[model samples]
Structures are given as structure tokens and as C-alpha cells.
Target: MVNELYRKQLYFPFSHESRLEMLVEKERKRLLKQRIIMHIDMDYFYAQVEERDNPKLKDRPVIVGADPKKGMGRGVVSTCNYLARERGVKSGMPISRAYRLCPEPECVYLRPRIDYYTRESEILMQIIVEETKAMVERPKFEQVSIDELYIDVSSLRSYKRAKELAKLIKRKIKEKRKLTCSIGIGPNKLIAKIASDYQKPDGLTVVKPNDVDRFLVPLDVDALYGVGPKTKMRLNALGIKTVGDLRRFSLDFLKQNFGKFGEDLYLMAKGIDLREVVEGFEIKSIGKQHTFEYDTRDLVEIRKVLLAEAKAIDKELNDFGLAYRTVTITVRFEDFETHTKSKTFALPQTGWSTLLEVGWDLFKEFYYASKKRIRLVGLRASRLVELSQLKVLKNETRRF
Candidate 1:
């Protein structure tokens, strides 16, 4: 009888515009219902792990990366604790600068131990899986990185239950690992990710479907996913400094100015993201970058850096049992302008020689096109294929 009544209502001879409005409203309601995604980020992961191992380093500023050769090291900072941040040290800053900011007896500087960190990550992942199983019968999980992940618990269909699960996971991680994590729960992945980063170490923020706009509007435009420094500058030029400002522009105007990405910005301004959490991870590419201690116009020196990066990448590809069909080189000029050039072969290639040859060839383009001194260089091997899937292998005997 309820089905018959609903069917009659659907054919009630409503005006075309009214019918369209009703259909749109129905679709919106369906899309907004019962989606529960949670994002978890281990707080200050690398530095936090170092602090955990040495309780004495607990409150002191800890930096985990290359040694600062007394304000002269060439390497970059990997990660630092909040204390270091307060002292103006940040990840990716030059180690020399970090030394100047938080020098000597005041700071606890340590090198990164990839092996030990991997073990700790494995333990944390096990705890995550175990606790997830204990809470939700079946949950979709996606590990974004070693220190970040997403869990979809739509089956529970209750924000209260999801919050309880988040608390439980947090407790379990702290109890077993003596570490803390921040969690964000929202109706979709985009909102969840932003919420997770809303607060710092050991934070929990939840944004319901109805509250997404309110949570997002007051934030800066750059806080939206994929809005990098360059994009933010462009948006700022147009007076779109905040998400609320971005919302005032018409969809057509945005599309006219920004093309395909403009449509994405428009939807993001309204807090609409339809992506789902899928299990498993894929390596899209592998690459390494090096920043020069001083900018230089020397092509030979740049080529040497490219060769070293290629050797490192070759080792990684072999370790993964993969081969690549494309080589890309990234160049950042002294003025901070960055550009990338790529080359794709007819078939996959192995070993470092191909990367060096192709990379140097690509670099000459920018080297000739500009008089700008290069501040950094990078090399990437992409369009990867498994060695087991290939019928031919080239230069397999040669090692970089």
C-alpha cells in the first residue's frame, strides 16, 4: 500500500520545474545519507617515533633527518616536533637553517631509521586492523601513507558509533604503541581529511553532512585539497581568499577562468565530494629531489646530481621488481619558478644509464631556454611495469 501511494505521488501531474526540483532534492538526500568516513593521521610521525624510543627527548625539540654540520649541512629537515616548530624549524627546510633556528644543546637531532619506523608502522597497522574488526563487522580501509589512513564505516550508519570507534582506536594505539594520533570523521573523504588536520596532535574532529559548509566556509582557500601555493596565489589575485569568497563566483565564471579544475573548485566550495574509500595502494611513480646548497648555472654539476638520483631510482625499481617507460626531470630556478619535462620511450627501460641520458636531454631544454640558476633538481621514473609482466629486459646485468 505504501509503494502504491508513493507511485501515485510520483505521477501527481506536478509542473515540470517542480518535478525537477523534487528529483534534485531526492538525489541530494540520497547522496548525503549514511556515509561515515574517518581519517587518521599519526601525529608528527617520524619525530614522534624518535621521541617514543627516548623518553628523555619527550618535551625537548626533536628533529629527525640529516645532521646539521653546525649551520652548514646540505641536507633537508625531514620532520620536527612541535617544540621545534615553535622555534621556527620546519620539515623540508634546509638543515643548516634548522640548526640556526634550534641549535645544539637545546635541540635533540637524530637521523631517520627507516627500518625501525617501518616496524613501528607495521605494529600500528595491525592494531588498526584488529580494532576495526572488533568494532565494525566490515569496514573499507585505505592507507594513504605510512602515517595516514582512511576507514569507511557506513555500515554502522551512526555518527555516535563512529565516534566511539574513533575513541577506541585512539585508545588502543596509545595503549599499545605509546603514541598519539588525530582522527577526523565526516560524510566523505575530502571533509574527513580536512577535519583530521583541523587540530594538532591527539585531536578528534567530526563534520556531519549538514555541517560541512559551516566547517569549510571560514577556512582559507588554500585549505581546500589540491590548492597549492601557485593556485592560491592565482585565487588570491581574483579576491578569492577564502572558501566563502570562492563560493560567490558563478560556475560558468570559474570554468571560464580555470577550465576543468574550476568545476572541482566550485563543488569543493559547496562541500561535495563523491569519492569513496578503496582498499589497497598503488605506486604511481618513484622519484627523488635534491636542493643545492647554492644555486648554480653549471650544467655538468647538475648532470652529476641527475645521475646520482637516477642510480638511487634504479636501485628502487630493481628492489620493487619493476621497469619504467617514462623519465621526468624537475627543475626549480633560483627565482623559485619550477617546471618539469618528461620523455616516454616506446618500451620500458631498466638501469640508470637510460635515466641519465633521457634526463640530461630534457634538462638541456630549460638550460638553453633560460639564464636562471637552478636551485634544485629532481628525477622520476614512471609508467612502471612489473618485471614478471615484461617479456624482455634491457641492461639487467649492469648496476648503477
Candidate 2:
């Protein structure tokens, strides 16, 4: 009878698992409250760069992308300033469409200065790293992309200190580069990533541990990272519209449907994320690219750019004591069409000659495919392995 009673109690809607979950969740919130993470995103990065270079374009709508060709260009806009956005222009929109949307006489369209942008990025990254060193114990810096990063500053142990650091970083960038960025602070990467975009250009938003649930529950389920359109459709089919609704489902139900991603969704709905900021030279790949001043079918210019990019990538690999077996090149043509080609070697390569030869071959293959007038060219080295690890593996194989 005792066993039967306990079995019935376990079968009840509010079971021991539910009670234990509440306690576990409370403890999790308490622990997470102590962590401090920051996500910094450059606002209108490319467009802002152009604006800074030419102060005359500051107040006017500026677009940093391909020529619109008077509403006939075929390519996409890489980025635009907020003023252009207010007039219905957007990134990734066709240049022709952007011209049609804005349809104004004063909107300025400019080609992307890839070299100039790269120099600015190097300078800004240096400033950020230098700022972190000024702080206690040099925080973890995770560069997510050319213009986004995550910093773990839990060592500081105070929100006030974190904000001060963030402000200093921003002030330094403004002073040096005349650029603005948006920053978000949270307990983990997910919250920090979302919070950074919660505001617009040059904004800062913070989310405390206790406020995590309140901040996330009312938002759309799609707001959580990794919930794509297809996953969202499936979630909506189950009447899970908001993050709060998603919290009601059991992990088993989510797993039965979404496999591992379902578990992630369940945790995210409750404002739980366990990810760390990876420090320097901790990247899967390194790359360099160039956007031409004008579209051209000339293979000579294309080859030169590829060679330069290869040399740079090779040097970066050597600096990191890393080797890569795969090389990829991306080409955007005058008509705004794009294509990418990749080649993988049996052994990881660290030689400059090898990188250039591989990069040139990849470029030749892509150039011959359509022989289109190239607008932009980029090369990347991927599938990396540390030199030490490669050496260890070779020694082990020799014994065999």
C-alpha cells in the first residue's frame, strides 16, 4: 500500500521531478547571477566607416556597397546607415531595389573599400584588447565576426566595473576611429548577444540574473538563437508562441521532436546558457578579402588579390602555430552574382607557396566557371590543426 501510494504520488501532475526542478532552477538562477558577460557589436559598421572618412556624408543618407546603376544594378547592399534605413533601405536588399525604395536624389551610394575597412578593424581590435589588459587579469575576448565580440569579465565581480570598462572601450573607439558600437551585458553569451541588439546604433543594455526570465518570457520564441524558421513553424504548430509557452513543455517532448536542439530550446526559454568566451587565436579559420574599386573581367587583377590574401592568411596561420588543409575563395561578379569554391589537401599546409598556389588554382577555377566581371574576391584557410598536435600525431604514427 505504501508503494502504491508513492507510485500514485509520482504519477501526479505536480510530482517530485517538478518540485526538484523548481529547486534546481532556483539554484541555477542564483549561480548565473554572479557571471558577467558582454557582447559588443559595431553599428552600421561599413556605412559608418565611410561616414567617418568623409565628414561631409555624415548627415546625409550613406550606403556602402555596389553601384546601384540608377536602379538597374544586380547586386545586394552590404550595409547602410540608419538614415537610409528610415527611408526603407536595408542590408542584403538588391541595389536596384534599394534605389527604387529610397528613390531620392541625395542618397549617396559608394563602393566598399575593403582595404580601408580592414585597417579600421585592426585598429579597433587593438584598442579593445589594450582596454581589456588595463582591467584586472585580462578578460576573455571572443571575436565572433569582423564586427562582433563577446567578453567574459566575471572576474571584475561588479556590474559597475563592467559598465565602466564597456564605456571606456566605447570612448576610446570613438576617440580613435570615430566609430560607435552597441553593447549588451548579461550572465551568458546568449543573453549578452540578444541584449546587444536590443537597442540600436550606439546603445547599451544590461540584463541582471533575476531579470533574465522577465526579459525573455514575453519575447518571441524565435528571439532565442538557433530557433530558425523551420523550427519556429514546428513550435508554433504545437501552440508554443512565446518563450513562456515554450517553458511549459517537458524536455522529453522537445527532444522527441527536435532531437538535441529541443533541449537547447528548453534551457534557453528559461534564460539558461552555458557558454564561455574563448580567448586569442582560438578560431577555426582565418581569412582575408578584397572588394575591387570597379567590376572587371581581368584575371590579372583577381590573381594579384588572391596572392596577397594567401600571403596574409599564411602569416596568420604561422603566428597561431596552426596549419590548414582546406582553402576557399568567394567571388562576387559585376552583376551581383556570387560563387565560392574550395579545395582540401590530404595534409595540412603551412607554406606560403602552397597557400598561394592553392588560392590561385581555386580562383582560376571560379573565374573560368562563368568568366564574370569580378566585384569582390575573398580567400579563407580552414580545417586547422595546431602544429604541436600534428607533430604528436606524426610521432605516434611512426611508432605504429
Best by TM-score: 1
In order of appearance, the predictions have TM-scores of: 0.84, 0.72
Tell me model 1's lDDT, rounded to 2 decimals: 0.86
lDDT of each: 0.86, 0.83
Question: Per-residue lDDT tens digits of candidate 1, residues 72-180?
Answer: 7767899999999999998888788899999988998899998888889889988998998888978988988888899999988899999999999999999989999
What CA root-mean-square deviation does each model show from the true structure?
Answer: 6.7, 7.0
Clashes of each: 0, 0
Most accurate candidate by lDDT: 1
**Which residue window of length 10 is worst by lDDT in model 1?**
1-10
Output the TM-score of candidate 1. 0.84
